[model samples]
Target: MIETYLPNVDWTKMWDATVETLYMTAVSTIFTFVIGLALGILLFLTAPGHIWANKLVNLLTGSIVNIFRSIPFIILIILLIPFTKFLIGTIRGPEAAMPALIIGAAPFYGRMVLIALSEIDKGVLEAARSMGAKTSTIIFKVLLPESMPALISGITVTAIALVGYTAMAGIIGAGGLGTLAFLDGFQRNREDVTLVSTVLILVVVFILQFAGDFAVKRLDKR
Candidate 1:
């Protein structure tokens, strides 16, 4: 059955495409996690009831997250083309698509992170404060560690979401499994390539979800 539609096409090429997808997804995920976690921490600390609460800071962070989250990924990609080209010297590959992915994913991930942090026990924070921990110490040593399980889950969710974004990036010529699928399946009318790409994407998502769940369960005391 596999031989019928994809005949004579190198399977290794598909492997290369899959590697490209992983490359884009991994890089974007790391940047998004860092940026999102930082923004999330800021939002939590500056919210009305937190120790470092400041209305202005809270408002600014919230506004920035909302602004980025509101922009559609495809539009953001097109809108960012000039900047992407400037950074990457070509706006049609995985490297070129990265900045937009980071921009699109970071705010959404930030909001997720904020929610996870907000769910941490208020009592734990108070206990940390009573220990005379500084703000930075409380955030890094207390809040972050306490929310590890939730953060792990959030990272899994973000990874899967970014996979979808990577597929869309393929539309703009970012070579990956998606691009191969699009060209062979959509443009060239080969259903087998499409099927293979779809299955590969699902496999990757399942792996991410399983790994994330395992980490969360391992870290979660309750």
Candidate 2:
């Protein structure tokens, strides 16, 4: 019955492609979150009046973030090819896609992180400092807690973007649903395959959004 309407759809290959897409998204999200969070914190803390404020450092960090965040993802992938090959040993599979995915997503996520952290109340940070809280304590206890909701929201948006990035990466032979859709579906004139792959990508994105919203709701005290 299922195959009646979509006979060209290869369930086995679709499953494998779905797994590859999920693998790429999951691994990249973890790295993007950590690296983005750190970058955000650094940007926040080093801004004009913050604890680690330094004109040169803040300028340099912010400039780098803006530069990478400004690049188109597909272009970024192409630009990173040499580095990706050097780091991943090949640029044609799920694992090889990681370097480009993370590098492209991280700076964008970092900017999001900076936005989330900036929304934090300065008085709270000042209070923690006045109480003699260590920098680490202030970061872990004050800044992070106060901005938890925003941070979750930001990452949620970034994760969704990463899904799109994975699709773009697929066009370049990165081995995911994008690859399946473009190579197996589009090139082979298999519309059903493309449709099925697109549907699966949407499913993954919806799940990420739902989970992120649920987490934000739980973490948000106000």
Candidate 3:
């Protein structure tokens, strides 16, 4: 029955699609982490009683994070069409999809980062400040290092979320396993292809989750 269902399908093409998905997911994850870390640090440092506390900066950053994080991914994708086009000169493909993914995931990661940083011991921060550490020095040396495990977990979560978002990007011509499933299965009514693609995506996500969990466990002091 399975043989009859998926006979002679071009799996090589599907494999290629999977590779593209990985590439897109990886690049977007890196960009999201960098941007989130910066914003998160900014949010933390500017919060009340911190070394660089600035009420207005904190409010603005908090507001932007909340606003962007609240916008649904699909809607954000559609809403960002013009911006995507402006950035990539085309609004349909991995290139176009990347900016959207970065925008959607970065602020979310920022909040996660802020939460992680805030979880650190306040006394530790005070000690770092008393040692004549600059704001940048404290963030890099004290907050980030102390919160490494939590940050790792956050990255793992963000990576998994990006996988889901990339699947949705299929609707906009972004080539990935999602596109394969949509084009070969949903649109064409090929259940075998759809099932296979679904399984592949699940496997990929599970692997990412496992790897992330392992890293978090290894890094975590608690």
Candidate 4:
């Protein structure tokens, strides 16, 4: 039945592509979360009145995040070709696709992190400070704990965006479902292949969203 409906679909190749896409998304999300979290923390702490407040630092960091975040993902991939090549030794394959994925996503996620952190009650932070809590203590015990729900929610959105980016990267030979869809499906005029790939991508997105929502619900105190 499966073969009859999708005659052109190669199950083996499709599975490989799905694995590659998952690998790229998983690895990139981990790096994006860490780097974005750090960037968000820096932006939050450096902004006017925070413990590490420094107008210059905040401005510079914010500028960098905004600039990178504003660039379209495809353009960002092209722009980062040189850097990706330098870092990964090739601008093709799942590994090569990672730098662009992480770079494009981290800043975006960073903004989300900042938003999440900002939503935390300022009074809690002030109370921590009044009680002689160290900066690190406030960040770990107060800020992160308070903002975890939002932070998880933000990363869920970023991870879904990365799924799309992987497809775009596939246009340039970054192997994944996108590459499979473009090269094997579209280029070869196989609508069945394209349809299958689209279904799989949707499946991945749905799983990520469900997992994220579950985490947020568990973490949310209110």
Candidate 5:
């Protein structure tokens, strides 16, 4: 029986890993949204036909977002090691991984935001302008409010992606369910431990999706 050969799982370790993973995901998501929302707004405003309409600004910012988004998460983590060390004093642990997680997710989420904002009706902006709305008013009142649902859904997606990143973060000593899966499960040949960690990650992601969707439905006017 596979169960006969299966090693006993350390549930306390699994619980700890669950907590760490949640903490990392929550902190990283907050950081990503703060940075990404600003970039996304800039991208929407600076586009060729958009309100700002600065060619140089659009190209530079768009290029930067693309470059960061194109990097694979695993390699991105490696590339961010020095920056991480500089920020947090060590290249290991949840705190250190925040930089990598934020950097990697922010740009990707920014693009999602760009798409969300771009999809809004041009008439909305036109009406706001006709009403003598200032740029700040257009952005705060019109742009963001119209795209709130999409933004919520986009962040929901980003949170799910961060779940994957958190697991990989464990490879570099960024503690989480990932570390348990690696060191205790695969390295020790404890399939039971591996299965439990994997299951927990699924549960977390599922809960995020359900909660995010519920909020989107509640907040969405349409």
Candidate 6:
């Protein structure tokens, strides 16, 4: 009777895999935003005419962000193998995948942040400077607050991208729905497992979009 309903998926294993996938996605997303936000602010401040502007710093930092963002995630996983092992004592689990995801997604998200920040009006910034606002004051009070809507949207997009990255991370033995679907389902020809995993991933994407858009609406004063 139970077999008739759950044919291939062991409920316990499926739940555990779901938890692992969410864990990887949550941890990586938080760190990626933290890193990306800082880097984005730095990039904006260093661009020509901004308070902290420095030609060499902006050039070097922008180049580094571009270099990392340009690499494909699969290649990034392989490249970060040694670093992952060093940080987490092994590179074949969800935890190990965290560093790789953070490194790869952070800069990609950072670029998004830079674009959002750049869209703010120069007049507002000039007004702030004329008012004798400190650099930190302008960033925290003027820039971040004004740009929250765009930042939230950028974060939503980046989070969606990270979901796909987590699946690819499963290729390196990172345990998640992706690992279950790819290794167990594909290898054993278990269509039920594959289908269930795909559906769950889709559901996750939908939830992220809904939650992100909801937040954006609440914060969007205009």
Q: Which candidate is the best by lDDT?
A: 4
lDDT of 2 at 57: 88
Candidate with more favorable, higher lDDT: 2 or 6: 6
Q: lDDT per residue, candidate 4, 82-178, as tens digits? A: 9998998999899998999999999999999999999999999999999999999998999999999999999999999999999999999999999
**Number of colliding residue pairs in each model:** 0, 0, 0, 0, 0, 0
What's model 3's TM-score? 0.96
Those runs of model 1 whose alpha carbons end farther than 4 Å from true positions after fitting are none
Give the residue spans of candidate 6 off by over 4 A: none
How much is 203 displaced in model 2, in angstroms? 0.7
Report the lDDT tens digits of candidate 5 across residue range 1-222.
644544567767889999999999999999898899999999989988878999999899999999999999999999998888889999988898899999999999999999999899999899999999999999899999999999999999999999999999998889999988998888988888899899999999999999999999998987
Model 6, residue 112: displacement in angstroms?
0.6
Sequence-dependent TM-score of model 1: 0.96
Q: lDDT per residue, candidate 1, 1-222, as tens digits?
A: 767766745589788888989999999999999999999999998999888799999999999999989999989999999999888999887898899999999999999999999898899989988989999899889988989898989989999999989988898888888888888677987777788887888898899999999999899998
Best by TM-score: 4
Score residue 52 of candidate 4 by CA lDDT. Answer: 97
- In model 4, what are the clashing residue pairs, if there are any? none
lDDT of 6 by residue, 155-216 (tens): 99999889989988987799998998899888899988988888888898899999999999
lDDT of 3: 0.91
TM-score of each: 0.96, 0.98, 0.96, 0.98, 0.95, 0.97
